[model samples]
Target: MKNIYDLIIEDSEKFKDYFLNDEDHPLRYFPKFNSINIIVGANNCGKSRFMRQLMSLNSYDGINDLLLIRELIDEYNLYVEMFNIDKIQTFIDKYSRNIAGGTILDQKAVKIQKNRLIKLKEGDFKNIISVINGNKKKLDEMLGYSGMQDDFLKDYSKIEDTYSKEFKPKKYYIPTLRTAHSLFQIIKHGSEKKLDVPGTNDYEKIEKDIFLHTYLQNYRIDKSVQIFTGLHLYRDILNSRNSEKSIRIQFENFEKFLSVNFFDSKQIDIVAKFDKNDNEKGINESELILIHVEGEKETRKLYDLGDGVQALIVLMYKIFMSEPESFIFIDEPELNLHPGMQRLFLEQITSNKDLINKKLKYIISTHSNHFLDLTIEKEDVSIYLFSQRKNELNDKQFIVKNVNRGDNSLLKDLGVNNSSVFMANCSIWVEGISDRNYLKAFLKSYCDSIGKSYPKEDIDFAFFEYAGSNIDHYIFEDEVEKEDVEIVLKDIKALAISNRIFLLADCDASKQSSKKGIRLKELEDAKTDNFIPKIVWNIREVENLLTNEMWKEILIELCNKTLVKSHEAEILLKIDKALSEVNYSDFAKKYVGEFLEEIRKKMGKISSRFILNRSAYEVKSEESFGTIINKRELSELVFNKNFSWEILSRNNEIEQLTIEIYNFITQKQ
Candidate 1:
């Protein structure tokens, strides 16, 4: 399939003239494209321009000779560049399939890179070497070699060019719609009258003058050009279509793609009508009857309604009736679409079995993230992010880089976007993501109980790391005896992570924790309102908030999931004994860490290992010290799947804490 694409790369004659893209771009085309190809980038990044180039494929004939057209003098100049005295001998020593054929840089000839190998005339080597008359054409005359030497050079150029341009993706298509909103009208002689689709050629010569109502001469169609007008093509489809199936199939597809609320239960039919003024000219053009349902079930023409939905109907009609493998490009398909509808559109385009069965490839450029992750991991989807900028030459230079399925760099960019510091009014300092997850769920539950709204992430509040127990080792908020004079701030800067802050720290049983001798007291005493404190008293960590019943459920599920050494009833008895000592009446005052520790020991004896999710599992010992990727996993399991926020929502202490947090972070004073 190497022959399927021209052996032309970025700097070569083909890619150079067409796209002034990155000169050293490694790829230009794919022989077989995946079912869906998405192009993404910042605005004005040439994603749309690149899509048009891929569309040119329908008209593209693979590499032929832009050869032979160059004069002998042109060939001479090119050969002269290749014929440097020192370099020419080196080229012969390196590439020549003779003189022991210098070892290839690659020892293996892989299937993709296999191509022509140049052979040198060994006997004429000395004669050819001595014939440097400083001119390429003159060298041929002096050495008496065939002029076909230039052909060999072109072949070698193309062979190297092919390898670099051919990207050996893991079954990824190389590169592969803007919809037209223009009203379909009567045919004129020029661009407006021509069909957008490529037409088959029959070699008929077109007359100088032809209009929709009249064709002076029956022009022989050229396979490439717009041989027939839009009207002519429309009539042609209806004429060829079997009245029972063809139009009905098209209607079915149109309905399938129709986004609900985009249009009502609408009807469409292609009808032929002739103008009485041009009575002799039958069937002046084909017209589409577009039905629309407004509130009153009123009928509307394509021209009557105006919205993206209307434009979409015309857009879809073109898509449904397009020639097989035709291109559909949409720029910012998210425009005017709610994020919900954007996802709906992605579903229809990517997963609609009919569209998939038809094997029509889509190359859409979008700024919306809804579509980015939608197909990023699908086996047959290829998304390339474009980076366009201008170079010192003041001409645009494009960087076309592929976004691999597993690469979340762009998604992380979106994540970072959602956490912009300016977007938040005040910040919450939590020790870890698991803490953040638990707190967020509890906050929402509190809001639900009071019929108040939960503040949005980032915009209302953001969470920064709390720096955990490490503060015990060295004092960050300690002032009188500052350990590091070169530190970034005078006191705990986490206090000022935003304009205002609320710190959620664990009430560990260690000395000075309850009093906050060196930590919260030092930090909060210095900046009262600026650093409100919530040292969760009586608990070692946020997980202690889970009710004893909830903990039992989680423990049981964890044992069931991971392989264990102890019997279920034995583990259950241990869990019950640990809880019996907790004494719920004194839960808010007595340290709960010992009970948790006892339960942890019991769980470990049964099965130290715990499954967080299908793909991630870990032993209890490993989670205590490191930054865990799946505290996140276990957090979701706790909050999302197992326990409801019901207990946390109504807990008197949490209710007070949630109310305080809501007021403190949401407004200025």
Candidate 2:
């Protein structure tokens, strides 16, 4: 269970290595890090080469070679070319670079410097060789020293030059942006090959590998999640002519076979729709099409989906549908998507507990402040920035810059969804008190019917106060950081749950018309979960049947039929009355009972009542009441409540198959 941060790389200091050229500074400056790192720099800053160095480090473990190979080879070639003899006398030929003759020359240079230093230190030049060599006369003779003070001194220049040459460094792999194209070449040919440095071949392979492993194998190719990672692609045969140009992504499958045209041309966009039967759809199969805007004159081209939509879909595929333990590396996730979608993506990914339970990991690199503002927690993530010093040739890279959100509300006011300040788990965003009140009750019933009682602490359902899809726009405009939105479901599900029980007396789609309200047909056409009742009527309908005074009587009869006698029926009537006058928060505590102390324990504290829109009710500071509500009571009244979610213990093929069967049966009417 090593943290993903194990890939953290240490920073580098330039201007130290004599062998490093100006271009090599950045490559050696930053240590390699883990997760998906987005290296940003203007052209010529060596960012590409930095990437190459990372690849090289990953390719080889240890092999240090500096200028040693070149110095020896060059010196030997100089001597051989100077003589031009096919065969030489044994002694002269022994002076070759490959032999110890190089070492003899090095020894001679060292002796000369030692004697000169001795003369200078003692302030005496007399008997220099006698004092320096002493009994090591062979070393002195090998140096070929003559007893002339001026001549020995004049030869000092030659010894200095030789000493400099002897101190030359060895050879080593130093990746360069210019040679990045050859990333895979070095891997394939081994370190012996001249690195092509900064070649696109390597970049292409890395990109392919990421898409294959994270998107293909773990997402689209994963059968258990029923995600078709390649659903975004489309191919249309307009006529007999084959397409001359096609933009598509291809990758290897689980069977180790290359699949081309796996997705259709970008012309048709596809999105996987999930219902109550979220697990019953195609395991690795999907469909592709286009979405037509209501009043827009043109249809949205599949490729034309906003970059935010594209980014969101891909992010969702990775975080939600991929393998539970997969590593998620998102590079500039906010790219192409609108600022609002950026926040939406962040909120979605961080709020889902299913991901945390699976031990999934996410490394996102973002430059947008909007992406940073919505974060709920800081410990789960690290923020970093890449900056260059004015005097330094290469820019510096580190986890954080000058801005510290800890002391200020910059992240909140600016709406950055850094995992630190924002919640990053399963979140169900609702609109207003009515929806919140009803969903809480309905979700309890839903979870209980499924056997694994829904634990309120792990799941949070937040209300956005009737903001509509504009909530999406708000989250986007709020921050610009690397947050991934896992999924965005329409409001239909919330409305259905609200109406099914009497939480909402009637559901209507209406707009203010000239002095009159006009009901919208689209709202009626909207679909609802089959488990929900189809009675759509105002409070008058219920009052007409029970006359309001005995409204709880009808509920009691309904509960009795379902065998939910543990809970009194009058509580339901009192709850509705309180809900009509006050918010769900106040109604829950004032009438039904204090639910916040329990809810607070489950979902962190209420903080400011404004967080969940219940600033009025003062929930007790002690004791927890998260388990007060139960879903079986309601489910038994409407349908069956003996269903179970534990179809299998392990996430294997057989378990997935069993889940498919179970989901199909439970989802059926």
Candidate 3:
């Protein structure tokens, strides 16, 4: 008759003694239950095993009874051996005196012991005792009792039951939908052959059978239902005159749940149809149907609804009607639900005032990000992430870790590939496509020079291009009425809470009227711990970082492929003249004075006469310097193995920037 809390305390004390004497016990800590707990992991990390352990403790069947008895017996023997008790008389005297004195033992203790002894007498232990009769002396000596066999036989059946009471607080397990559907088929076909009991052979089947049995026992509406069909549950609820108002309220709430969140234009009602006349088989037929009436159109049965809708209905019913303080284990509630529905379903359950008042506890195992994301902001929820580690023997050992808020590695522990922007450890927000190209090319070449692998998976870096240099979109808030400098730093600090963020901006000092370099100074002034914001220090634009030699190499390749054979030298001379004027300082100047004007005239004359037979001005105006030097092609060339890092290293500013980026990604915070 002890409550679950008292039983847990008793078990904990016993386990503490056991672990103190045996230091290498695998389980270092017992799982602590919470109002709501989540277990998340990849395919096989013992998540289901953990849930089954809880189920075993909550429900007592034959296998569990035997295991508990064995455990108690083992503990009893350990106590006897530790105290060096050598006679049956001594132990029995102590047990009897403890009961009579009303000191350490109470009536409940005697009753529990008697119950256990009675079970042993009626069960298989008689055969076990008979098999050991030939070695009675040896068994007696092992038990530290000279007449153990006769003593046990004389005391067991004579102990009477002090009271008849059952344990309170039951367990309910809703297995995965696939398993539930399979069990339904088994019940419908009347193939209720007993499966192997748990703690015996065929552990998986036994575990599934236990879950199915527990769910049916907890939710069965009528004893004569034959199978736990939805119709039976509906009929029981509708026909209960004592709780008519409560049942109607439940149905109305469910209808609201469907209408507000699922179907906007549909009204739902539960109806039952019965045939008064018996057929030739002498059976009166009855059925329960959930009707959904769409606006001015047609009505359909609930079974005609999608699988997701049906699943939600069944899931919600269980949650609403479950007893207070009950333990519920749901495996993969996200099975048939879409991502949005998954979020909504969890939200409804967690926020339901009635369910909250009931003090029910929920343990869910899932692989859905949507489900886990819902738990992040809820303070009462506990998240356990399971993973597998390979031991020296090359076997997978399961490990479970409790995930806390502000754990930056949460996404990584969930087995999310960091190549995704949402999960990346380090995210670089760039100004445009060209800026992305430049960073990627530089990172590839730098890693190659250092003899390290590029695009490393562990410290994944994701590059996102904002539409413009104004990066307020990536910033967390707009209410901080600070200067632009503080705004950028605040954005970086905010992002660094969940991820490592960096801003790559162009050093637009040449524009004279631009505020491009202000954010970098602000970042330096703020001195945030984990944010890395930098400007392109070596050049005016990202395109300016392209070395003149690389640019010439690209142009020569383009000219060889495009110009006619006879005017190759003429085209090469014109390209050289154009390149000489296009230095970093004047690249964005829009006008280059008389020196470029003369080169333009010569290029115009040559192009007008021969190349492609097009107008000279048309050819000259169509191809700007940026267009001719394709950023994509230039980036590919930079990542090539044979490309000169020696030449790139000459720009100390770029080299320093690359080293900073490498350190930011590789070093731990």
Candidate 4:
């Protein structure tokens, strides 16, 4: 599977020659394995481009791909039509303005006068009659017309306020209509043409092409492939007859045909069927029967099966079996499938580990985190974030970064406080389940005590859990543009209601750095690897004070606790009792002092824990307080006085993030 990376396309510049602005350029550095990835983003953010590029690598084709190509072609044609109409309209408007009122002269009658008296010549007679019968009766009478003149002015006077007089066709109407009709005639004929190749007759030629180019060029056609495509159309059924009741396979004319029963074969014959009344009816009402072929005798109407079942069969028979080693792109595989079915399909794909490695891989783009959660452990899997950045000129640039590779640091950059339902706006990303659960419980208890009506179910957060501790490993894209991040934030920022958006992270320490206050050296050491250090050196300096006097008693009781006591105690259950519990009575007596000291000493330090009276939603970082990330970090820091704040200083976006988190927390349904 690692050999998949043998073709690295890191230099994107080379692709610039192939398309307009290097369209559909691909990255050379992709994960190595026979695995599937789900690309997610807002529409038109290059997901399709990437998938198409991948498919081009192996020339995969199936119903989905064909459908996508058709849709794209349709869209392109629409664009061309729109452009053509806009150009024509603009030209007509410009020309009409220049020639306004010019067409009215053609319908007007010219006067025929030579020596003060009018002589009615052949053309002048028509004009003279028009003057007397049309709207010029007064002028005709003044010219001495003998017969009684008609009331020519009764209805017509160019219809005041109406612009119809200025209207005129630039050319003959039928000629233009004929040209347009001719243009569409090609479309009507081309629609019947085989998708990729031109001038090919029926499905047999397509099947033969698929076989010759794909599987059969190297080998002979087998019974399975023959039967699978043979029954695609109904016409092929009647021309050939089978000796037995077994599933009969026949290739008649240009159609692929297969049938089960003798009566079914007759049904497949494309002729119109007569009802009891014997009137000719359209064939649209006929039933389409598909043989499952999985067992001895099972035939079902095509419409009877669920969409997911149909999709599964089509994909398995048409794509999986036919297009080997090609990129299989799926958009939301969860669509129309039950959870059990989803799991079943996932397991089925995962179980074919060898086939997956040898001749198959997939790039499935989706918005469902549930689908992502199912495949967290695949080594070939990675996550990418679409992010955006705004320039000084107010222009936006979009970026796609590999979150797994630590390229852009999305979770850190965005400062999303991911929670669920209540903290619905929070970008709560967790490295493990323990942290996720603990943070949830801690938030629930803290909000409850604040008298803020914090319903456990009302906590608004979007918790994204990763299986591993390394945050960078989750990134899927290599480089993300700033515009991309902003586009993503546009959606995320909408969820915020007023809670401080905090990225609450934890720092684990070994015995050497077991002190309460985080040392500057420890902070540096934690940042050395591919991980972001959570320890705040400045905050820990103040936290260390408790270790000698107040913390000794608190630490001792916490370490030796034999029974669960308080909410904090229960929440920290996973923390070995030896490392994290305290006697409730003692904690209450000393808690006030610790909180007081935090307020006084850690007030303005960039790396110290301070007490935040407001929750995550209410906190905002002003110039005097800090940045967005800083304000957010302050709120999370306030929750635990013993935690250091050095890590918070490194993130400049904390203040804005804090306000975002707070707003998210307080937001209602």
TM-score, prediction 2: 0.28
How far in Å is the alpha carbon of 406 misplaced in model 1? 13
lDDT of 2 at 498: 27
Clashing pairs in 1: 177-328, 177-329, 177-330, 178-329, 201-222, 201-223, 202-221, 204-220, 205-220, 630-633
Q: How do the residues 1-669 of candidate 2 rate in per-residue lDDT, one tens digit apiece?
A: 113222212223222221122343333222222222333323333333333223322111110121221332344345344552332223233333323433423333222221121111111112222223232332233333333122221111111123455221111111110110111112344564444554311111122223234533432332222222222222221110132321111111110110011121112223222123212221123222344333456654434555445545445533543444344544456656555566556644553444455444454545456454444222344343333333355534322231333324434333345453333222333334333333333343344445432322222222234343332222211122344332313213333222221112122222334111223122333324422212223211111111122222223332222223333444454435533443322322121224323222222212222111122234344432122133223222222222222321221322333333233223432
What's the TM-score of each model vs. the native?
0.39, 0.28, 0.39, 0.28
Worst 10 residues of 3 by lDDT: 1-10
Off by over 4 Å in 2: 1-301, 304-307, 318-324, 377-379, 390-669
The candidate with the higher lDDT, 1 or 2, is 1
Model 1 C-alpha lDDT per residue in residues 1-669, reported as the tens digit of each score: 111223223222223322223545334433223456676777666676655444333232222222321333344334444554442343333333422444322222211112322222222222222222113453354233444333322121111123456221111011111222222333445554454533311122132223422321332212232222222323434453545676567655765455233443334333333222322222233243444443545454443455556444433454565444444555556665544445556655555556655445566777766567456323566777777656577876666665676466766533435443143567887777787767766776666565455564545666776568654433224233445655534434443346567777776543455545456555445546666767665555565566676566655554444343446667677667666655443443333333444455544553445322222332346323212234664565565532344666545665666677777766634
Candidate 1 global TM-score: 0.39
Q: Kindly give the stretch of ten consecutive residues in candidate 4 with the minimal lDDT sum.
A: 172-181
The local distance difference test score of each candidate is: 0.47, 0.31, 0.50, 0.34
What is the Cα-based lDDT of residue 460 in candidate 2?
28
TM-score of 3: 0.39
Flag regions of model 3 displaced more than 4 Å: 1-24, 28-32, 58-167, 178-248, 263-267, 272-288, 292-297, 389-397, 406-414, 418-669
